[model samples]
Target: MYASFFGLSQDPFSIAPDPRYLFMSERHREALAHLLYGLGGGGGFVLLTGEIGTGKTTVCRCFLEQIPADCNVAYIFNPKLTVGELLQSVCDEFGIPHGHNGPGEETAKDCIDPLNAFLLRTHAAGQHNVLIIDEAQNLSADVLEQLRLLTNLETNERKLLQIILIGQPELRTLLARPELEQLAQRVIARFHLDALSLAETEHYIAHRLAIGGRHGALPFDRAALQLVHRMTHGVPRRINLLCGRALLGAYATGQSVVDRKIVAKAGTEVFGDLPAARSAGHPKAVAAGLGLVAGVALLAGLGWAMGVKLPWTGASPTAASSAAGPHIAAARPAASQASAALAATATAAATDHFADLFTTLPRAEDAAWRALAADWKATPDAAADPCEALPAQGLQCFRSTRTSLALIRQLDRPGLLTLTDAQGRPAYALLRGLDARNATLLVNGQPRAVPLATLALYWRGEYATLWRTPPLDDRLKGEKARAAATAQWVSQQLATLPGVATPASGAAAGDSPRERIYRFQLAQGLVPDGQAGPITLMLLNRATGVAEPQLQK
Candidate 1:
């Protein structure tokens, strides 16, 4: 009803899980990364859990789109069935014939035999099969056990069938039961999707509005957005409900913009006279009836809770938009670019890292990326997406949720680290220096040295960094014209590295580029896939003096 009034092409707040409207927040990206990691994990249970309406389904939908051409997927949205019914559903979804062939009814074995046969047949054809069960928390113990047993079908190398379980937090608790220990042990990857922080909430709202085709500035000001986050607790679904109604409230009352008043009024209508929303007059509550609304403002209080900065610190939205830039930047020689005095000052500031100075910068993700960009001395277009803009400067961004501090140390560069803050929200910090015991983190762009133990308390091994793109990078896309150039460069770089023999003549027989890349990868402790991927190239760049940031040891 308010769509035209708001000049939106569609109802931006619709609760549908539309992929176009999917906002890939830092947490959502990690959740999707975990799902993607499961595809190559050789076949085991990959679990994703979250609170209701926290975007599990949305992430699953996004994951579905990214499934490779060779992988066959069977998805079950409803798991509230008996073991037999679930087994039958699996057969039905996979198109495997099961159930009674004769007079008697079919047993669980009836379904398993055919399913196993199907899995083996597909495995022989070099195709992987994945079964995703959504709302798995409702699954019975017997059903869960049967699902686990399905994983027993395997080859000597890997299990034939991979299963993914998506559900709410209770799913984690359910898996923790003593009886389900065996099943839990089989989980190869798991990530809990947390609700968005206030900044993310604002971005989420703007993302949906932009997808809905809104023009110009947001109808809801910053205060209204803050109120929305407070009322909805940063859950996407709740934000939708309140924002949709608040827009309608604006349209009916003929208000041009949605302020705190409209949101509080809409909250009352949506949440009703709930006790939480009807508390006695408190200073935190803006109005007598807005007891349920969050009283704390998003900028200062939210920043402190999550250990990030807000726009009040003189950083513009352009900087905030690049928060967690699309591509991960490389981390190395960070201190090399800074003057010795500045580097020493940053190192000294590490111990007092979380001091009052921390609150005066941009968001954690933004500060980390900016700090990284500064270290590299590459100017990425602030108004454009950093991932897209950085490549123009001969730089490449690599992001991975499965990386660790060990790998970061191996990469020997300063990069961004995702940390869990005091409020359990995802925070960001730039890792600039590391030694055995203490690591220096550029929190809000200031070096704060913290013990590895302290860093582990919040960091979960997810990181992003930048690397200098090799000159041969463009030729790597199978351009026939550059094939010789690419191979020659690869051979030359490898010949200079240790343990790689330099070819005597123009080219050595059987000494292909792939073989040389594989050998280089082995020496560098990278995945030896015989392909010159980003990380492999980054290591090569580092070894060949291609000049990128370096982490202080």
Candidate 2:
């Protein structure tokens, strides 16, 4: 109807699997070509898989049409059958008569014997037999094994029965199971159909319109076409659904061309409240509309995005962009420039690359904590949170952003360096010793003296430094008591600082004490290194305008 309204001879965007509208993109051609090549060779399992609605079935149909006239096909569309039933179905599809054995007497082996006889008889007659199982992912392990064993019916040179498996992505995973190792090894060739790219998608739509006899300007405008791609992710079925609906929408509105707004409204009907659509439609709507609540969600989302598992949240770590991390909106140009200069100086100091003797440690975070324990003369759990665990040893973990090795050495303490590997995996290295040109690092408990340039190459200019908090009193027996007294004073001082949000009643001064400490350090013209040192503490005390510094040396 949309095609006719647009002066097309046929509904080009119909969701039905019509070979007339089968636009073969490069990927589709390759997938089809690969499958066809497998069919020509001696009998072995040929596998084809793809995500939902990527035209796997269409490609298979096209290939089947092009197959040699002498080839015999036993195509199974629905494979949800028991082992005996599956074998019987295969024989039935191949026109092989099964023995009329008594009830409950005909076994899977009984069906296989006749199929094997048929395959052997066909091979002698100079004809090829191919068994194609569609939706093979639904086939149970035992049923699949029955299929594999059927391949044993072979002649002197090649398999008498050629097998092909086609399904969704689940089919690929199903074949990869350890129990299917035998079947997997018999696979001669495999190909996965993928969705079209943006350019290919544009071509696909145009080609279909041309096929429908409407070659000129399409009803979908440029923005409308782009939105269709975003909404459908180049999935053919989804594209059809959206484009068809958008055309109807345009016709109903008495509009000549479909626009992005129409496509968006169509998408709402096709896919309700898609997350990607929301993010793309309004980048800052959530943050701006909800205000403070949005900030909390943003922070939580950031944490999850960074693959940082919060001990309290019990949420699994999620993969994110390599550059993804917590966003800091505050200005820190001095820190940025200083880090750049340090990186340059560090690179220039090493005239030659040192021998790479570093071995990646088994546990990166653990290695950093181990190095800190060595520096502070305290036993720390490898898995414990440094921020929480260090306090029990009368110490605290402070994070700082710094680039200068000299400043890090001036503090004369081991710290954890956050860096990215070549592949962009987050890595940790403990800065144990800092020399002029080389630095000793404990990478997961392995020791090495690497060039500062080597460290600078991967360092993210972020590190964690440990600080020993002076005991509150001589007779503070309980760790909780000491921590309470320290938290009370720190919270009070943090509350007094300008722009620092006060915590709830009976809560600590700042929600994230480390963040508060960083703000304080920056306000005092400190490095904002996120480390608590004598100088940062002194500056923080002065800015808090509090009596007697509670954080002692």
> Which candidate has the top score in lDDT?
1
- In candidate 1 the C-alpha lDDT for residue 512 amounts to 63
Report the C-alpha lDDT of model 2 over 302-330, residue by residue, as the tens digit. 65679754332321111121122323112
**Candidate 2: where is the Cα deviation over 4 Å?**
101-104, 279-553
Residue 230 shift from truth in candidate 1, angstroms: 1.5
For every model shown, what is its TM-score relative to the native structure?
0.58, 0.50
Candidate 1 regions exceeding 4 Å error are: 273-553
Shift of residue 268 alpha carbon in model 1, Å: 2.2
lDDT of 1 at 534: 72
Candidate 2 root-mean-square deviation in Å: 26.9
Q: What is the C-alpha lDDT of each candidate?
A: 0.72, 0.64
Clashes of 2: 4
